[model samples]
Target: MANIYKILQELPNLSFEEIFLLQEKVTKEADFRSKELLKDVENTILACPQCGSKDFIKWCKYKETQRFKCKDCNSTFLPTTGSSVHWLKKPKLFLRFCVSMFSGNVCSLKTQSKEFGISPSTAFEWRHKALIALGQESPIFQGVTEMDDIWFRYSQKGRKGLKYSRKRGRSSHKGDNDFVSKVLMSKERGGELDISLIKIGRLDKSSIEQRLSGKFADTSVLVSDKHPSILSFAKSENLKHETFKSEQHGKKDIHVQTVNNLAASFKADVNHVLRGVSTKYLQNYANWFGVKEKYKGLKDKVKTIIKDCFSNNKAWDMFMNTELLYKDFILKKSKRTYRCPTVRYRKHQNWNFENAKRGTYI
Candidate 1:
């Protein structure tokens, strides 16, 4: 078996080839480790923000910046500076855990915390920041577009109290309700569904007109699931609009079933990992899944996925600081403990700082 101790030690300094060989050297090492090692390699190339210089002193490590100082500028920076983990308590493991969760390996907050040797709250914070960063990275869909909405319900058994009981199981926010109305927007040819959630009140004609303007040319075709609201807007814009019967939702060449299946799988996976996440933050989690699901089925598996995510150096830099990204919190009112904040917002909720600190974002 490979000596994980030796691999972990060398992992900080090893190149991708060396890391791969070390993992390969240990016959029983999980293939996942090799991917993690590669991610570590890519993580090291943080150029100097001041000078854009990759010439850094690799030996001088700071607690904040995992890498050494930039010799050219005499400045120090973390590998993910300007990225989401810059202010992180545990930068190295934070990135690793993120890759782990995205790869469907370490799937839960509890599991990730234990594996990475972090407090549950710390793990939760890392996960959340990673998610916010990932969502920010999703490409803006700008071709022929389709739009629709679906309703997802959340149980309120353990929520605040009987006072808001009526509103409990229903959506917790306006955006979420709008998500129901604008769920599946794009059903393109050859089985691709481009989905986006619009804010509440943004579902009307003026909203669509504003959002869709310049998104497509005057002559582009739009498809939907025959929602009257969607059709009405299509007619108003004088754009080509086609509606499919419910049975024909994913029929052959005209089907968006593949994307729907993907979305369903994503929802189930997230719901399972979060285990009763408040409805308010559902869309943020949904957005997280969208970014992850985009780069599907690479030939090299996990390694390629990690590389691609970290390759956008500038984007990565901007998202490294946790404090700069997420500013809200979710609190379990009954327990008086802070829950992790969701992308959505809720009013009059209470929180436990200790528990709030431990939410997974990505």
Candidate 2:
């Protein structure tokens, strides 16, 4: 406080040009800071982030913030220990980055990178960190859950080490399961949403169960197009099921139109706006989509997303772990057999296209 006052007192001694520059700097700082998480987040963080215990106490100050020792977990942690900003080098950039990330407007990584003066990789990483953190708050589907499957052409947009030309162009045409990535989108009537990337090359009962088994409430009614996988999932979960043919959506009250629209918009953002993303980061983008939908029409969308980035501790672990496991998944199980760049498949593949369908010939 004293330092701020002292600095202010010196402003009168500066030339008009210097004063103008100073004002510009201050305004920019204020703009970014307004979007930053407030220090009062400490009050809301009454429990230990690790063990969810309320008995933690401030043990010390580190990096200008309070660090506490959890009584139950016997672990030391900062308020943001489990959050996206936990390991961030530049905390000031969080909310500013989120404005571009969670906004209704589309921002490509390159554009964000240029705008924010960050590398494209840093932009990508930061975007996913915020997304994966927010994904921790999965909605519990209660009543009238609309469900549907949306597919993206298989992509390994950022993968390396290919010796042959990658697959490119329109795929998923005429049921090309071998080159498509499957995603399951579900939304309850109350606006609770779940959009998950199931896998490459098929929407199956097992995949739907993996994303939605425990998400639906006991009394929740499942609605969808008559995809056998959806029916099988509803049966397996013992959920009250209602479905219609894709063409018969509006004829009766039964429809999955809510989630269907969500899927289309999400696909536009992922495939068109961002010009397509890598298969590995598809789930992160899905979570990002959830962030937008969850807070749509709400004020302080950036503020809410910033708090979310600080709230979820487990998401950081999962995001990093998934990166570690990506090698094996892309190599052995990605179903990107033909032009895959992960391992030598006895197939020569020259890879290109930042937006390829597994980077194959379209």
Which model scores highest in lDDT? 2
The Cα local distance difference test for each model comes to: 0.50, 0.70
Instruction: Assess every candidate by TM-score.
Output: 0.56, 0.78
lDDT of 2 by residue, 1-362 (tens): 47989998998899989999989999888865653454645556777765568898888888677778988889898777756676677877766677666764767778889988999878877877777666543468888888877888777776676665556667636684667777777889876887777667766787676556688878788888788878888888888998776678687779876877888888899878888888777877887788778888787876777676666655555545444345444554456654433432213222222212221111
- Residue 55 Cα positional deviation in candidate 1, in Å, after optimal superposition: 18
TM-score, candidate 2, is 0.78
User: How many angstroms is residue 357 displaced in model 2 relative to the true structure, after the best TM-score fit?
Assistant: 27
Question: Ten residues in a row with the worst lDDT in model 1?
Answer: 328-337
lDDT of 1 at 240: 72
lDDT score, candidate 2, position 162: 68
